[model samples]
Target: MEVRLFRRDETDLLQLSIDTLWAKNHVLSRDKQLLNYMFYDNPVSQEIFGEENYGFLGTWLDGRPIGLMGLMAFDLNVKGMKKFGFAPTNWIVPPEYRHTGAGLLLMREMFKWNPSVVLNLGITSNVARMYTGMGGYHVLPDVPRWIGLLQKRKTAEMLLNGDVKFLRFYQEITAVYNQTTYHVERRFDPERWNACYWATFAKRSIGFARGASFINWRYFQHPSFTYQLFTCMDDKGNYQGLMVLRIESILGGQAKIGRLVEFMANDQDSAICLANKVVEIGNENELLFIDFYCFSSISSWGLESVGFKRVLKSESDKLVVPTRFQPIDLETTHMMAALYVSKDVQKKISLIDDQAWYITKGDADQDRPN
Candidate 1:
């Protein structure tokens, strides 16, 4: 068996890995829509993250390539933001090999290349336990709730009318030019991945200091998905909040499919005002499903009042895969899902279970846990 680094020059192997991740042996068979949304319509992101961030590893069994893994530096986005990187996003792996140690090997290879900041993305408890066995530490846990907002809402006529005051507010977004606070207000240039990713950090992780500017650029500006930024303006014309969106076309035809990339609210009234407009836009666009993530209950209230319902019924988390460095005996893990791994993003790559993650002990990979 052989395990090696991913070379971009190997287009056939890469495409084969990508296609396998997209289907065939995925955790959830219904993830094709999500993949189509991510790879097909969202060209900007596909171009930015596709071939670049992956640290591909191929494992050969019986002298034939049977397994593969793509180690993604999920945090190394824009050029400026590359400084703070993490091993959050994970691709596909064959089911048979997850219990083995190939998952750890793939992750170790990912760390060998990135070796930047800590990875804090969420993961299922089962996978987390395996990760603990592998040497990962507990950072933060988030639980994502599937939220639903009323499709039909009654908005304030004052905003719908867009009186003189509202017009001034709209004009103020571009007028106020304080690169410090208002820097968040700067329109994200599609050509500039740094600006877009940094802008995302400002609104998303206020305290988690460092982020990859280049990584951010690739998140929204790449060729895979289209990004739409909705900036907020106070009645006084001051900049308030920013919302990023990624839409995927679905076959159901209820406005296809729509997603709220990220939404941040500076204050209550400002949040209420901003949310009102977003729902209006969603209604106009005929969006089938609009999902939003809120950090605080206060901010969520505005979205809730506007008819959006909570998703998971609990604190929803942005989950990640099992880390490479989890400590085995410590066993500090989410008891409910100590070894859990989400079937969500796995549809994006194809990796033979054993080969995707290799173990020192060459054991048959027919047995898998979750």
Candidate 2:
């Protein structure tokens, strides 16, 4: 048995393991461009780990690939300092190989990279338990998912058995003054984005680095989905915030929904402007509802002010708004995550407080198409 890092050129081995063990016709196996876009073409990883150490760590038995684990590398912000971080994905060890300790081998190899932080977002309940048993990892059962109903009647019908009474306050919540200046663009302005980041988020927030390079690669270069970028500016035309959005059709095209994949703001006014822009987009396109999943209070307060309700666990089961839409799952869903912050980073930020972290659906592979 051999456990080692897979080079960028070993796509065949990675695809074989994914197709054989993960899913029969998985998109990663069928779409090499998407696969490369995720693990290899990531600008963050290329600059930090270089091409040789591109993300996959695989295990082989008798020279045949048996298991594989993919790591999506990014730069984590720790109170103005930049540090290496990675989110694990595509981790699989077939039933036959689970007993061989191959999964543990892959994990052990990953630790050798000495990442400052490891974010395991969108993990399963079983995987959450595994991380709990490992110790030193903080597991969040549910990341807060906020939803704003654009068309109350239609949204209630789709998710709540036509019970419009349950959403009576929808109008009040979606109300916005819309007094700020904003612009919609296909690409991010690097200079303005970096300036916004340094001025507001860099000195205070803790999360993935949201510079222009990250935004461009994450949204514009995506292989499967199209995202609209909305830049919020002050009356004087200075960049203050940005939002990333994607419209999706669900329920076999019976309904359409809007996804707010990323939200960042320098101040409350900018946040409200971005939130109002999303509402405008949703209404113009006639989407049933728009949802944003995030952890930071700083980034989400504006959203709440403009009518996005934090879907509590108690309300989620009853509302039944599906989170997965590529194939349209009707069941209630909650995104679970695990975070391992090194001692040095722990001193700089609080992992126990959800408000200290700024994470959105776009952070990892959560928003990808099936």
Candidate 3:
């Protein structure tokens, strides 16, 4: 078996593996535009790996592809410095080929790139176990999830079958707020966004770089989902923060939900303003609830201050709220993650500290369509 990086022209071969092993109707398998948008059109990957170096790696036996692993390469921020990083996605090998060590081979090949960090978000329990047993990887059991109810009684009915007992206390917590000083816009201004990142988030944050190019490609240029961008500006008309949201229909359009994919701010005040704006938008749209998944104390504090309650582990285990809604899954689920940071990178920044990292559901393939 030969393990190597697949060329950009080999989409057919890669799609074959995805269709056969991952899922028959995955968006990546059939939508060439979406596939290229993810792997080929990434601005960060293009800058680091040249324009022609795509992110797919495959294991071929006798010139026939048998296994596949997709990598989403990006620039990681460490103490305001850019470092190469990648997240693995859609890694699969058919049962017939799993014993041949094709999976391991693909992983080893990825490591050959010598990325400063290898971060995996939205993983399964089985994959989590494997990552922990591998030694040198830091595994986070769950990334915190926060929910805010727009219409308490209606949300309770839709999510808990009219079990307003648990929501009685929160019912009085109204979504009404005084007009914010920040102005919100539905467009992307690349210059202002890059300036905001350099002036604020990059100075102290440790996570994926959120420059203008990344945001444009991840949210605006996405072919599968329609993401709405809420760009906040201060009284001086300076960029303060950004919030990416998507309104989803669940339970066969009987209910609507607000999914906050990305939340970035220049400071606590900006964060609070953005959070309040999200609540206002949710109420106006009559959404059942608004949910955000992230791993940052600053973000949590701001969200909680605006009435977003953390979804506890106990509640998640009991299926109090379902995370997946494309087809509506009722099973218990949490966002699991793992990170392998190089020793040099670890010295500069503490990737192990959840407080130091600014990860969101938008980080990897977590917010993608079903």
Worst 10 residues of 2 by lDDT: 178-187
Clashing residue pairs, backbone N/CA/C < 3 A, model 2: 173-307
| TM-scores for the candidates | 0.52, 0.93, 0.92
TM match of model 1 to true structure? 0.52
**Whole-model lDDT values for every prediction:** 0.39, 0.80, 0.79
lDDT of 1 by residue, 228-338 (tens): 666665554445555555554433332233456455556655456556665655656665445553323424655665656553311333211111111211122121211
Clashes of each: 76, 1, 0
Expressed as tens digits, the lDDT of each residue in 1-370 for candidate 3 is 9987777778887776788878897778888887888788988766655676668888898888888888899988875898879988867888898999999999899888888888889888888898898755988888888888778887767776677765554532243353667767777789988988878878778888888988988988888888889888889888988899999888888988889988877766677777777877787788888889887764676667778887665652444466776655656457889988888887886645656687788887877776
lDDT (Cα, tens digit) per residue for candidate 2, span 1-370: 8987777778887777788978998888888888899988999777755777657778989898788888999988876788878888867899988999999898888888888888888988998998897755889888888888777777777766777766664553465775545644445678988988877777777888888889989999999999999887776667888889999888788888898988888787777778778877887888988888886676787888887887755653444466776554555477899988788787777655656677788988888877
RMSD of each: 14.6, 2.3, 2.2
Q: Is candidate 2 or candidate 3 better by lDDT?
A: 2
Stretches of candidate 3 exceeding 4 Å from the true structure = 165-181, 315-317, 351-354
